[model samples]
Target: MAAQAEPSLLVDYAPVMLWQAGPDRARSFFNQPWLDFTGRPLEAELGFGWMEGMHPEDRARCEQVCQQGFASRAPFTLDFRLRRNDGEWRWLLETARPLCQDGQFTGFLGSCVDITDMRQAMEERRRALAERELLLAELHHRVKNNAQATTSFLGLQASRATSPEVAAALRGAATRVMLATLVQDRMFRIAENATIDLGAELLATAQAAVDVVGRPGIVIEAEMEPGLLLPVSQATPLALIVNELVVNAARHAFADRPAGTIRLALRRPAPGLGELMVADDGVGLPEAQRRNTPQGCLGLHLVPRLARQAHASLRLDVDGGTKATLRFACG
Candidate 1:
């Protein structure tokens, strides 16, 4: 038996194989000259002695699998860490096949190969994606700020124009620009992606409209329910409609008044419906100009157009001052 085992060492295959007689009775043997690498006799280097070369975290698991393989007469495949010749712990892919005979339980044979680099690369990719999303959010904030500055400049130009035709046209352009700006401005403040708080945007719009006049005596009162909050989809037309109605009141409704009061209110009148009213305590619409004059008829006609755009019905009451009420779908 010694002569046969010695000759097997020269076969150019692994000369040592690990085996177990029972659960805790594992052993390793090498043919002929191969035994010198261990620097110990076969008996001392078997069973629990192998723990010195196996990582502490891996030893218990490896012993468990070996015991299970012997009891079940099945193959064992697992992954674990091992101490290498360089004193470093390396990850290994371990596999063991049972060597049963005639349906009786037998030990398992196993080998291992190294996958640490692959796991580290996947972790790096995850971090890179997180950083990219952070950069995109910052870019959106900067772009919003720049757009608001441009809209403010346009408002200033409209305020300075001397011609009525030029001024009215400029005001219209400025109002549209501001409506667009308010969508993003309120969205940023509220931290929503595309929706805005209608109540907040409405207040801001009224304030922005008042800022155009630069007069102190103008008292603008807004009675709004918290329900004024709407998404940008609904806020856009509502804001523009409010803008036009207020502009008309400031420019024409208070033409001969000593004291002026403009009242604005927004509320939900019924399910799925919203109501808005703008009224001023300036001079009421002159009966002749309200119906006949083209120059004075622009605001009245345009208010309906804007209301129609938002699917709203416009009603005008000229009893004391111009009161334009609009009711429409919440969408």
Candidate 2:
């Protein structure tokens, strides 16, 4: 059999070492670099002597894999902790291939590379990502609480207003602010690992709207398909649109009715499209406001613009009663 020196191989590789057993079961040849790295003389590192430097927990597995390679004449690779000269446990990736002569296994050659830095870096990154998510959740919670306080203040001011028009305007403003706060709260509440589920979001928005307008005479009903999830970007606009439509229905549609129902439904309109419809069995929209009113209400203007941003469409069904339909891109 022809023998090759460790440093003479052509391929670029990390530092390597070689050991061959003699007839007396002692190392016959030990590489120069291995002696320098271990800071030990050839006598102390031969056979099973190297186990003294490996982490005690890893020594058994390392020895077992090395033995398998020696007996089977196959390549082997393993990752383990090894104690450095300074008594620190460093991670290492070790690989080896068996040596043979005349089709009989003789010894093995191997290489070791330090992976301590890489492992530490990965751990640090994981901790930083976890911290960032915690901070974001706390910030969203505080912002939602502040918004609720502002809505309460607005409601108090509306109650004290002398003019009916001023009270109505203040109430409208408070409703809009509440809608924005509810959207933020929903986004933060159901997010799993920083992603919002669109289906759950829509369902939550429907529930929140009903809660806000808790009128005893007006019955709120919602029908939605399961397993639809929207990312935060798409969910925000859809929630606000639903909020405006539902609030409008509760305020104006059933203003004079004894028994009324407001239905809010979400369904798939087409591929990559999510559709919502809000209809009430009360007074219909005025023809002038639906067709020719130059300066539309803020809610009307905002809902249509939001639908457009979603690459969706909006329409008001004024034939029988007030029904607002919205179609938007979910993809």
User: Taking the tens digit of each residue's C-alpha lDDT, what string does model 1 give over 1-331?
Assistant: 5556553444325533333444334645333322243345556656557556667777788778767776777777776675555566656666667655687545555544554565567779878867866785687677767666766776687789888788777666655555556544554444333555566667677667766755456788988878555665556667776766676677667677645788988889888888888888888787765532224555565666666666878787777787878888774
Clashes by residue pair, model 1: 198-229, 198-230, 199-228
Displacement of the residue 322 alpha carbon in candidate 1, Å: 0.6
Candidate 2: regions farther than 4 A off: 1-80, 83-90, 93-121, 192-197, 291-295, 308-311
TM-score (all chains, Cα) for each model: 0.47, 0.67
Residue 229 local lDDT, model 1: 56
Number of backbone-clashing residue pairs for each candidate, in the order shown: 3, 4
Q: Model 2 — TM-score against the truth?
A: 0.67
- Which pairs, if any, clash in model 2? 198-229, 198-230, 199-228, 199-229
lDDT against the true structure, per candidate, is 0.64, 0.72
Residue 38 lDDT, candidate 1, scale 0-100? 35
